[model samples]
Target: MKLSFLIKSLAGAATMVAMAGPALAAAQSAPSPVTLKGDVMLEKIVTENGVSKTQLVEPKVVIPGDHLLFTTRYHNDGAQAVTNFVVTNPLPSAVALASESAPGTEVSIDGGKTWGQLGSLKVTGTDGASRSATAADVTHVRWTIPTIAPGASGEVQYHGIVR
Candidate 1:
């Protein structure tokens, strides 16, 4: 799908995923207990002067099969540690998960309701037979951070392919 179409369709969403980094977290609430934010990055294989190189750039125009990595960075700024901090990021239909990602991350094929390892998820096929979920079938990715210490920060990432 074209980027313009996605912007037009998702613009109606009430909660937009604004890019909020650690600076934004610290400014408000005088140190957030747990602040999570997401960012999108585009990577493509470019051949220049007969040398192929992979480049990461701001998402603009992406073609089918282009690789991408979606990442969410979380920070803990409260006076105490936070346990079970979770971050959930939705995958745009424009991209298909192309690889197994973050070790502790869970994938959802049924939107965001239920999630598990891709191999462990079962979905009914068009013919009404259950089958193992494929990476391309992922709809969302979630991670459960065991614990985050005060003023600590970390990031989780997932791989995807433009489709």
Candidate 2:
């Protein structure tokens, strides 16, 4: 299949070593009140010749210092316009949130129990030292989409670094 070849070709062309395939993409229940489906994805950032780029690849295997991206696509399958849509996603334990841009988005560090902007979050170390939460302490990501017309689709994503 074309998709299988594309994955393999991209894996080989990327010039990175990883035996694993893409991470398992997940779709939590649609944000309530909107008949939409959310799909998740993983992307790898590749820098070559000092020019960096990202490709849609799996994280079959990654180094602790590697940077990655987690994205979600939402499709409005209903016949009505959806408003005030919010999407939430949990980050994997292996990666910390990367300083990236996501308009109208918030993050959580307490297992999705709370949410806030990065500078507003704090992570406490075992040494009794409390410091501002870095990308590494991010445990979840959320996005608030104002509206999506019928038959239209939108996507939201955040970057992260492998721990």
Candidate 3:
């Protein structure tokens, strides 16, 4: 009877460890908390006839040198607060900022891949295509918010000049 109890206890312990393996692995691999927020959220405001809708009403496509306005909002839903963290988005090839919003945001002269301050980030990509990511291929708007607290949100509106 004693031997049987010992065998059963060992088997139960092994089972418990197997069940907890994933939790242990995640704890070990987790990154340390920092000022940067953990999770980011994006949403588009759709309106059939509203002026401030996420969905583009007027045709986004335009002739070269023509400009169109675009808007997008982002929310922080993570446990951390984001400060001086850059937000980047790709604009349609045929768009560019006409003017901009009150609080000016950075525009990356390079494509939408990397971002920087109000200036631009230098890019060096192997793609030789004209639309490839490059410092000269400004197709994005970037901004560093003061602090995007968890559950807080921000927005960006800009112009797109059709190439």
Show where candidate 3 strays beyond 4 Å: 1-67, 99-103, 112-137
* Candidate numbers sorted by lDDT from highest down: 1, 2, 3
Residue-wise C-alpha lDDT for candidate 3, range 37-142, written one tens digit per residue? 2222222345576666554445534456544455566676678886775656666665544443312556666465555543334445567433323322566776
Per-residue lDDT over 29-94 for candidate 2, one digit per residue giving the tens place of the 0 to 100 score: 444334444433456667999999877666677777776665677778777888888887888887
Better of 1 and 3 by TM-score: 1
lDDT of 2: 0.73
Local distance difference test scores for all models: 0.82, 0.73, 0.57
Supply the TM-score for candidate 2. Answer: 0.64
Q: Which candidate ranks first by lDDT, i.e. highest?
A: 1
Off by over 4 Å in 1: 1-31, 46-53, 102-104
* Tens digit of per-residue lDDT, candidate 1, span 1-163: 6999888878756344444455576687574577778887898778999999988898898789878888888888788999988788788899888775634569999999998887788989999999987888889998888999989999988888989
Q: How much is the lDDT of residue 85 in candidate 2? A: 86
C-alpha TM-score for every candidate: 0.71, 0.64, 0.41
Cα lDDT for residue 6, model 3?
A: 100
